[model samples]
Target chain A: MKLSDLLETAREDAPAARYTVDDVVAAGRRRKRRRNTGWAIAALLAVFAVIGLPQLIARPAAPPATPPPPKAGPFDLLFSSYRSGDLRVGDPEWVSLTNQLASIGREVSPGVYRSVGRLVLYPAGSVPQTFWMSHPKEPAGAINGHEASFMPLGRSALIKADTLLTWRNADGSMVLMASFENRLSREEMVRLATAFRTTSPRPARLPFAISWVPSTMRLVAVDVSRPEAATALVTPDRPDIGFELEPLYEQAQFVSAWSEPGLNSAPQPIGLSFPRSTPGNASAPSGGIVIGVQRSFVSGTGPTPKCAPWSGQHNVRQCVAAPDASSNLVARAGHDVPQADLERVAAAGRIVGTPGDPEAWPTARESFPASAWVER
Target chain B: MSDKEAEFREFVGGQMEALRGLAYLTCGDWQLAEDAVLGALARLYGKWGRVENPQAYARSAVVRAAIDETRRPWWRREQSHGDAMPDIVARDEILNIDDRVHLRQALLRVPVKHRAVLVLRFLEGLSVPQTAAALRCPEGTVKAYTSRGLDTLRRILGADLSIDERLEARHEAV
Candidate 1:
């Protein structure tokens, strides 16, 4: 019999599915309750952190004889500020920055702030601008002594000439000021950069942070299944397109998740083929697809890597290894968002807070609040 | 309940049977397929409003869950009904029934992903692009899987009936 005939027979002979609508509705309600419980626990934790209840509950025995290994970086002092949750939306410092930038645009939405990150969007006429700040990978260099980088947004050339200005605070925190309208002058940007200040450190919770966000998108939802695996969803103001930032446990997982399926089901001979050639050097093996390469990492072991990221239409996944080599961060986008933008955003993923604590990151629902969206 | 909940329930009711069938084709076991479908439906219910294409998303989730189920240690230990192939029928007595049983047995032997591609492309009648979106893989991969899955099924069915002959007959019938 023909393949189509067999498939048709299978479909026709399939057993009757036995499930009631009530069964599904009950399951959904249970899921909602569990999700709400998770949020409640997170909120309680935030309250406890704010009230210093952990200290009051259990006073620690006095100091160690050895001075704690000198804090790793100058930013260590700023960790307390992050922990205190003092950098949140209503903080005087953030309020002052918002007020100072009011001339350019009004705050159209409530800001989303974590211990080490802050995101606030402003609408100026047809353009959507954002004020974002987070701890930098390293101390940011000064742009004319103001600790900022001002350059044209490099993702697209046809898109209007938009500029991005990012600067560092005294405590090693970095702020990103970008204008989609291409109207912010360098002098005005520098003046705005000077207004940021280092507030007192407080205990705060921030699950994860991304170094770069696309001009048209805002951080929406973050779902942390575990510390090593978190998914951040981003949607544009207009809701035409959205994407996710997914953290896989290892490079192998990233490769398997992204790899393209081969042309045949039978295992193809293990080899490499370059489908897309590199731009400059014809001989340089770049941009071509790699097929069935075995990954040698502590966490990966299997035949035929199944989840590697390969090029695809509509969806593009770009993965980069974390600095510690413990995990891979993948940025995935669909529906009109360019690959260059995804790669830049993926490259900018930064892990803040304790690496493995599930509580450090916000749940999916909490990350994207109703107030976060600003209608066009 | 709420309007959103009612909407989600209606969607689940409409899509459940098809998704369950898809899951069964992928896993080759009724009980496991049910579990996968239920798990996927529960997750879909949670994100009903947020998901752009609930049907496509549900299909992907079911496929992933089915694949995940096969990886579990218990999956190998479980004795599915397909584990024991039915008694072979006489050559002409019940040829159609025999073919169906043999087809199912052959499908059980096929790899998880190849089986998934076949079920989605042919059984569900999803376009290459739609199948790719459902599987969250490249379209090229789906095309390849389709070719390979059919080839595997052809090999398992018999050497007497060439794939060319079957295709010619199918085309003539159409």
Candidate 2:
């Protein structure tokens, strides 16, 4: 009748889970789609404000054509959903008095139309790249008879040699076209911008999933250029602690890897003994390391380990390896956290699935094979 | 099916029962417990790859979601329907069943924060710092809440014998 026993008894009569996995997945996808739609619209509006376009209440008449529009690109269908008056299309601060022109401005080429508050483009690829359209200090020039502003590609760390292209819409609205992956020259940028048409925004999906979130922590940002290497930033209610999760592709390589120089070089060895009595007791390598001021512990031969070692200069960390020797999970806390507590956190590690497919691990009480006693 | 989807389904299937139980213990209502667990699971599904410790994260999420449900206006409006205490026969049986029922009722009387601390610490076997981390509070707060919560439960149960002593005795008998 230990306290643990009482707690277990209290929950013995708990009801079964009513919802299925498919239901939860569906709900998650729906929520993500809604959030992505909002982001896409916001991005479109921000792009419009760069070139100094007036807000339009109604769709204006098409201007007289000067040149034939170019043929529609492969991605035209993806960009055709946006139109004028689609949720406050233009920003007031960007209104250009001198460049005020007819609404539904002339088509610079086939499939491309310049309107008061819209410039739609259908890029060929399905994958979206980060595009920056404006830099405050950059100089302006003319492209395809429209005043254009340009920013060098090296301006952003994520972009290499590409250039950002911005031009005034025929109705005086601004348009920007830039791609990090494809470096387009001034003429190509102009041609592509002139041949753009709006398409429906697709639902956004995260390449990776977060099976776990610390209590009181809200997911603030996600970086997923590669699904296997995705990272999630979570901010706790307390401002003092910062938490992030990144995949450890190879647990053994990391565990055996050399620690950074100029940091504490001493290896503080800690031991986690596996009890033979527990179910599914996998024989793991007995040794563990509590390295540096972070005190990150990496152990176990499991495929997917639950550990999150603080990436920065934090003094306390708990890293655990899965039973399969594939990936490691690292959790970092501030130096204020006691060493004993950090060990306990490390010992609490559980493996869900491989890095390629992260599932929720079984609870420690049910699946933690053998009681783990920490040895200093 | 995609590998990610298949993996997610396996995770959900394995952990659903435990999460539901934890949620039920925290919220004291089956329906709300289910809602809290499902909500947390849905969120976890969206973040499956980025989470480091999915079990810990799921537990923390379930607890927080349950706590959040109690604070809602609708949750507050619903009256708590207390469970009927089992009829006591032998003195030992009373100590086992009736005492548990009494302790549970006392737990509900404790403040939400204190109750959460008690449940996480005594029930989930989380360390002081781990409980603090899960609740997003300081270790000192967790220690204080634990002390106060146990005292409140002790008073509510109104047992002349120390609960610990009785539990120990019961264990030895078993």
In candidate 1, residue A294 scores what lDDT?
12
What does DockQ give for each predicted structure?
0.22, 0.25
CA lDDT of each candidate? 0.49, 0.47
Best by lDDT: 1
| Candidate 2: Cα lDDT at B1 | 76
User: Model 1's lDDT to the true fold?
Assistant: 0.49
Runs in model 1 lying further than 4 Å from the true structure? A46-376, B75-94, B159-174
Once all C-alphas are superposed, what RMSD does model 2 give against the true structure?
Answer: 42.4
Q: What is the TM-score of chain B in candidate 1?
A: 0.78
